[model samples]
Target chain A: GIQVEQSPPDLILQEGANSTLRCNFSDSVNNLQWFHQNPWGQLINLFYIPSGTKQNGRLSATTVATERYSLLYISSSQTTDSGVYFCAVARGSQGNLIFGKGTKLSVKP
Target chain B: DAGVTQSPTHLIKTRGQQVTLRCSPKSGHDTVSWYQQALGQGPQFIFQYYEEEERQRGNFPDRFSGHQFPNYSSELNVNALLLGDSALYLCASSSRQVGYGYTFGSGTRLTVV
Candidate 1:
């Protein structure tokens, strides 16, 4: 089994600020994704960067497969960004993702 | 096109009861996977269905079973539920041909009394 660990179990930021969430995995992964779970419990797909870097609006993610770690960045945060950010990975071809405990982000106005 | 769709957004059942959750995968996606998310924790894989068969399963018990239909819809059935069975059940869909990430449903909140 693979182990996925996320850092900064909790985070608080003021509006318009920037923050980064880290995810570390215990083994090499074939797929990795970043997700934002909104207050209503919908898991919104943020990025599918198994490697390299990608950006979308105010959110971006980078995964270093060799290092077995990934980072999700949120810039110019808004109160609507308040929720849990999760990083999940699949180590095998089965495509079953093992998720991290997530970083609970709270953005205040 | 619609993303993953799950039924019965919320449910309440007594211990030792049985429950079934339904899911319809995203358009053009053929694989469906189920996950369980306990309070304040990450989602854990329950099992996955492809081609109307169980492809891969996680470390769940036999009490947890699932089925996939020809149209790619799926169902998760849990029997003899316990109080600890309470959690958010999520359904994710992906295309094996596309070979990318998954799109998740809003999930079903189950509470066992």
Candidate 2:
């Protein structure tokens, strides 16, 4: 089984602040994804960068596949961005995603 | 398009009973995967179905089984449920042609007593 570790288990910031969350995996992966689990428990897709950089609105992500690490960047963060950020990776021949516990982010208004 | 949709947003089952959770993949998606998330934890892979076949599974026991219909809809069945089985069951849909990126549903919150 592969292990995924997320850094800074918890984070807090004021609205409009910037922060970066990181994920490190134990093995090579064919796919990587970042998701935001809202207060309602819905997992919203953020990015699916398995090996490169991608951005969607105020959020961006970069995965250094070779190094087995990925970073999710949030700029001008808003209260709506407050939630748990998850990083998942797919590997092995089975292709099931392995997820890190996640980084809990709280953006106060 | 309707993203992955799960049915019976919440359910309650007793020990030794069986429960089924349903999922309909997002339009144009062909693969369906199921995950379980306990309180404050990331989703844990349960299994994946593609082309109506079980392609991969996690460490879950035989008590956890699933089905995928020809229409790409899916059903997860848990037999002899235990309190430990209580969790938010999530269904995520994706296509290989689209890489492994997935669109997950809101999930079915199941509680076992």
Considering every candidate listed, which one attains the maximal DockQ?
A: 1
The top-ranked prediction according to TM-score is: 1
List runs of model 1 lying over 4 Å from the truth. Answer: none
Clashing pairs in 1: none
Looking at model 1 chain B, report the run of 10 residues with the lowest lDDT sum: B94-103
Q: What is the TM-score of each candidate against the true structure?
A: 0.98, 0.97
Predicted candidate 1 versus true structure: per-residue lDDT over B13-102, tens digit per residue: 999999999999999999999999999999999999999999999999999999999999999999999999999999999999887788
Worst 10 contiguous positions by lDDT, candidate 1 chain A: A91-100
The total number of steric clashes, by the backbone 3 Å criterion, in model 1 comes to 0
Any idea what lDDT model 1 has?
0.95
Q: Which pairs of residues clash in candidate 2, taking residues 3 or more apart in a chain or in different chains?
A: none
Q: What is the overall TM-score of model 2 with all chains considered together?
A: 0.97
